[model samples]
Target: MVSTAPFEEQAFGRYRLLERLGEGGMAEVFRAKSFGVEGFEKIVAIKRILPRLARYRDFVAMFVREAKVLVRLSHANVVQVFDLGRVEGKGDEPPAYFMAMEYIAGLDLATMLTRCQQVGVRPPPGLATYVAAEVAKGLDHAHRRRGEGGQPMGLVHRDVSPQNILLSWEGEVKVTDFGIAKARDSFEVNSEDSRVKLLRGKYAYMSPEQARGRDVGQDTDLYSLGVVLYEILSGANPFRAPQPLETMRRVCQADAPPLERLVPGLDPGLVAVVRQAMAPLPSGRFVDAAAMHEALLPHLSARHGRFGPSDLADFLRRLSEQLATNRVPVSEKTPIAAPSHLTHDVDHDRTDVDLPDRDDEMAQASRLLVLGRDLLLQGDLPRAGDALGRVLVMAERHGASAQASQARMYLGYLDALAGLPGGEALLRDGLAEAAAQGHRAGARQGRFLLGRLLENIGLPRAALVEYEACRRLAITDDDPLLATECDEALARLA
Candidate 1:
């Protein structure tokens, strides 16, 4: 066991250390809690500077300067620094500098890759584009950050390594640890080619200019980012070597391995972007991160059609119903057993139930419901929900049952798929109103749908109540298949 002795609290006042999260050669990080504010608990990664390096004035100045640079650029995808201070301690205590940054509750890309190796999993197709887009946003924020003089700070993250990129639990890709970064005018040019020879970041991700000790610019970071992307999509680095010298040589002289050949079926457009970004010559790459995003936009989007999570969820739900219930039957002449499982229910259980209606209500409700279902089939849930949700707005605009309870059921289903905690309750409320109207088919269908909603949201036991109710309603309404389905669902739940 890595002893917790190094991580014990009381080393730093106010910031109570909880557990050690990570350690680099120069710094030790901890999961910490702050005593400064009420209910202000956070995972703060503390990088305590090495005592040996403390004596070196240049390294200490550089370290603190980097922290200041990071504090100024605050974007959603960039890690935030709450505070930066010197850890005051006695003679042997080591005059350490610490940076308290927003604790990212996820692994760095390097660690994520190790997990992928452990689980034997490859990243999904669109995931690379999505991740690249987010990272580009972070890069864009950092690259374009300006000063009070209204001049570009000319900041470029020279070290864009997997270790510095964090993936949050919420699927957010964040760029962090801007240590060793260079300001356009601030960086001291040691030699004619000192820019390339300094060796600030990991060699595996270095650009050709960086490797060859040549003058580097923003395109260097772009090249490094391309290498990271290549490594992420394919399991191997674009340039690898058995020795340090060999690695540098490969970075200078080698061509990036053809990604398409390695990761077959990979998006050719994405491969092209990576190829252009990783070009040996800086001028060959995209002018900026935004340009790269635009280039890969087509490949990053969803196949069949592109839609947001809400829209996609609605589409999948409606598609499921249509195919499963024979509402829009597929021909047996088709070779496939069923629709290929290529599509996913990204936000499967989010429902957006609208208000009740009266004037031209049924027609309005029908149109909205049709629009919602069409949007759902096309994988556009937000617009679908917006269209469907307007049914209630129409109802409120006019007065009740403009949708004839069926609209409520469809809207309720949408609400559940939306992943709202209160969505099931809303569905049940709709079911109660539906039952009160004595619409047996609606009641039966509502109960059946309620069971499905419950099941989807991890309320399997509660779903049984709906399933059983659906079974009884089916029997009362002479729906044999529905009753059978209810019985089967109950059995599955059991």
Candidate 2:
């Protein structure tokens, strides 16, 4: 596919952006190559904040803060951040803030789950537990991290979703994305007036305390890690509701269906571990991530007899091959060529063909939505508003109700930020449409945003109602993050 092709070798400091690897709401990642004297070349993943965000002082501060935090976190199970600085933009473009990190030649836990679902294969029980255990170890390190003077850093990784956990072909599991992490000694502490809202993590994976916008500690990270473990074993998040409010409700109630019921023949002991880790109240959970890791070790030993890193490596490699062979071919129009210095590993190459496959109108709408989201994150309100408007028009014309709802939600967010009219109505309509379509995740997001907007507009009573609804939904969906956010909003009202 033409999208895969390296249009040109673009230099950013010593690193050359060889190919676009992926894009997210806040940043774009590239497969970059850094060269040194005597033919020393290293491949790194370069995450650059979008142009719009890079120009914002608040966003720039957050990016720099993330780098500072990562620099202090040294652990085998945590992805290392190698370098951080600004790369001068081309022509009239602004300087781009970038971070060079260790590149794992493998898929994230989320993609691995999708692969397992597509192949109708449950990952080996031992492997699943092992991966989760490794993640817990990483969390333990972060939770107990100390500062230069031996003072407790009190670091809590607010975001611990599947996308942040990477599993390499060599069987290394690393936890990443401390961008929203909270630590006492960190350069930036999250405040109510922060550019980004108080709620920081993925809604589905947040702990109850986090969801409520309450102060989080090590236990919060444990709860999220438990959610990750549960999904790894069952291939579904326990508290994934159709609406943010519902998800919050589920998280508050800790009302996940029994694991054995979801995955038949799952070990009872394993289920117990998950239940304890996911307990709504912090006191009911594991003492720390270390304790959770200890709990899982025996289970791993019992299920798959003598399995180790090599076993995981072999399984991942085989799975990668199988997935590649069965993957849908991308259009020939978007050809991608890897940099000569980079090795063509199966795990890396497999992610090269993630382009959308749809009709022209749908594809165009999707592109517009992404552009709108990126622009919004970067604080380009007017341009983002226009792009989102186009998305809504295209989606409505194409009868893509879900896409239309999403566009409406983005526009609503923009309006809310801009203190414009129709924000509440647009958000409500979007949430209702998402719920009608069984897009619980989307609905959940909409509700959360709406609740925040209402609060910002001094509608405490209305905001409380929305937050309460979100808390209930979060509990039903077993989402601690949403639940905690609701709790926090409700607390503020109190």
Candidate 3:
């Protein structure tokens, strides 16, 4: 699929992008604040597929179907999906899609663990069990979610790691990032292609079957949760190794030291629970996520009397006060009530321009960068120059290096299309900047554009080098369409 072009609106369906939280191989996650009538402002996390991969109909359709199935999942322990939407392609541009989800104000388990490591304090044993118990409840809910017809959805959260376990400032645990989640019904759609059953996740958190690329079920989520529990209590991932292949081998063979042995004096009961949940065979593990939660509840009570969200909240509060640090990280601050001076204005930039918080501005800059590119594609050079130039200024002001690189790249392409000098140098510099920042997709795009330029200038060998590099990247990203394009380019050169 030859996917291209930009969004018509600056804000994606009226949810103003606040910050680019993170990006994965498949999608980019953004923190957005939605505005509605009568002072209604709601924070949501938006996960959108990368524009480069937007036209992969089979993959996008699979994600859309899973999103529809995910909307049915409503549990206190699971993060909610407020909306799922798609924008139709206009002319050469392929459709863009997104899913808006409940945003957690605090941090993930991984971040919390890092903070604890920096402060030299492992979480209390009871709290560890409590966190896992909460996650188990969420998993149970996801696994047993039913369709509108009352039949089982059989959802399996393929990626259940410490990073996916969100802890609110109020100490509530919510399972998040059902991005790679698979519904049982999804298998029948593309069962002919074995890649349909493939699961991608951190090797240390994967179940034996999952690590071996076999069929996964609800039990797979429980196994990953067990890894989380083990990490929390023992302060180490059981199968973690310096090398990826070694790590996979360890995970598949269950070749790790016993948790109790690794952390001396760890409650024997807790040890038993982790070991059983992480059993090599699916049958050896707990019957379901609910059973694991039940097993963990007693440990939570026995170790710390009546442990709950309040207790977790208190611990986080006290830790924040006690821990001394210099670097800014996600704050665990939770307000009891909205301030009296809060305004109903939807214009976030006006309120935050003077403040040190630049997420809103950065989001605005990102939007402009896209708009500039869209205008360039639409042959509106003057407007594209204005928008791209403004984005460069905003990117520099906020120190958003990646955005700055992209802005320069588009501006260079714009200049070339309009018969200007120094375009090639700017494109090369932008590609170099992107490479330094590890933006593989952006760098590959720059290479592809550079290849076109070189080919136009009667330099087939140089163009071949650039297209070859892009082919490798396409293969690495698992973008078959792009790989095929690169193959066609190479064939022409040959």
Candidate 4:
């Protein structure tokens, strides 16, 4: 597939551009075929320095340094930089400074997340961990790579945001774009600019020190990557605000909202790993990305076990109930009236009748959902389907809004996964109800699932719309791979 945007055919020496891949803070990447020896045609990425930043001495210095640093990195997970030069197009003015390198045929983490949101799916825990492990292996390699004088490179990827991480379609996590990489031997801070407030890297993923533009070390990268890991596991950002300044302030001071608060019944072990990795103090967090991965190892291993439909359903049910309960107005929960016989009767009906009854239904529905989850988790598809089937009946009979919505959603999920009859219609109807109830989260999830369904049906454009909605409701940057895939899908359509 090719992009519709116009691009030069050739840039720099020995590289004929094919299409524009993407643009970043420092460079614009393009897909190009290397004009290597005969019988050896290779697809490489050609990254040209952005014209706007060319005049900045420090920025240009960083670009040149990045090219040199990249040559030293020989890891499989790091995109290889092959050649660098300046090139002038036919009749074009000043030459463009560009680097030709290996081209990864996969979407970056950002696109993956968008795709996942479109499809209403999060990668399984084991897969997410496996991806993380790959990234860690790459980072570890770069960090440990020896420089001139046989000294430790001590390379820190100060900007480890999802956009900089590529989760290839072939199931590999490759870290890319190291323009701001901090290598112990190569970088020197400019004292004159020390007082300048320059918020480097993506604000959303910045560590406290990075946000504050203070001297940062490997721990800063680790903390940033921890935020990435947190997003992948919990599907929510640890710290977020409406504006960049506010978000930076939160990164500097606020505690991350608990994982259970976003997705209840998530493995507590996973939450602990994420929380520990994202600790406010550098000392409180993992010493490195490898340590962060180690913290999540146990949970990742456990996730390998089968997940039945019932277990998934139960998880969603419990999660939904928790979310709904959190929505109850504080005033509504306050004591309504003085204790009189008439007030007592009304109170009894409201509290005991309505609230407890709702609670009972939620509990019952949650149990049934759990049963379904266990069955699904265990890979008992038929039994899981049967379990969810029962919840569907109960939800319809008892009029449990949260449970009913959940049950419908699960039933739709199982049917789609099972390739059962009328699954699309079922999912569509459930999504409508979820939307009508103003369950934005539920609606977001539903749209994601629906978008995936649409994609399966060859409706990529519709799927993109669904993913866009999903992103609006995304609580965290977790599942970027899914979003990236959605973008890839859209790209295909484009």
Residue lDDT tens for model 2, 188-286: 434586744422346778888877778788898888988988887765677765466767776766767667655656789999999899998999999
My TM-score estimates for the predictions, one after another, are 0.58, 0.63, 0.60, 0.59
What shift in Å separates residue 168 of candidate 4 from its native position after superposition?
Answer: 1.8
Candidate with maximal TM-score: 2
Instruction: Tell me the tens digit of each residue's lDDT in model 3 across 21-139.
Output: 77765677889888999989998999887776676677778878878877878899999998998767679988778899999888889988766644334576777888999999988
Sorted by TM-score (best first), the order is: 2, 3, 4, 1
What C-alpha lDDT does candidate 4 achieve relative to the native structure? 0.62
Mind giving the per-residue lDDT tens digits that candidate 1 earns over 1-494?
33556655655766877788766645667778776466766657766665655655676777788787778989987888878888766866667778888888766778765443322224444555666677788888878889878898777777787888887655677888764544212334356755533324577788888877677787788888888888777755756643566568668864555777556667777888889989889989989877876776776566545423333233334333333443211111011111123353333232221222243344434444544544543445565565556556554445556253555666667766876566667666777877787767667877887787778769999999989989998898887757866886888888
- Ten contiguous residues with the weakest lDDT in model 4: 330-339
Q: What's the true lDDT of residue 141 in model 1?
A: 83
Positional deviation of residue 390's Cα in model 4 after best superposition, in angstroms: 21
lDDT of 2 at 379: 62
Report the Cα lDDT for residue 377, model 3: 47
Question: What lDDT does the true structure give each of the candidates?
Answer: 0.65, 0.74, 0.73, 0.62
TM-score of 4: 0.59
Q: Judged by TM-score relative to the true structure, which candidate is superior, 1 or 3?
A: 3
lDDT of 1 at 286: 88
After superposition, the stretches of candidate 1 with alpha carbons farther than 4 Å from their true spots are 1-6, 37-41, 179-200, 304-494
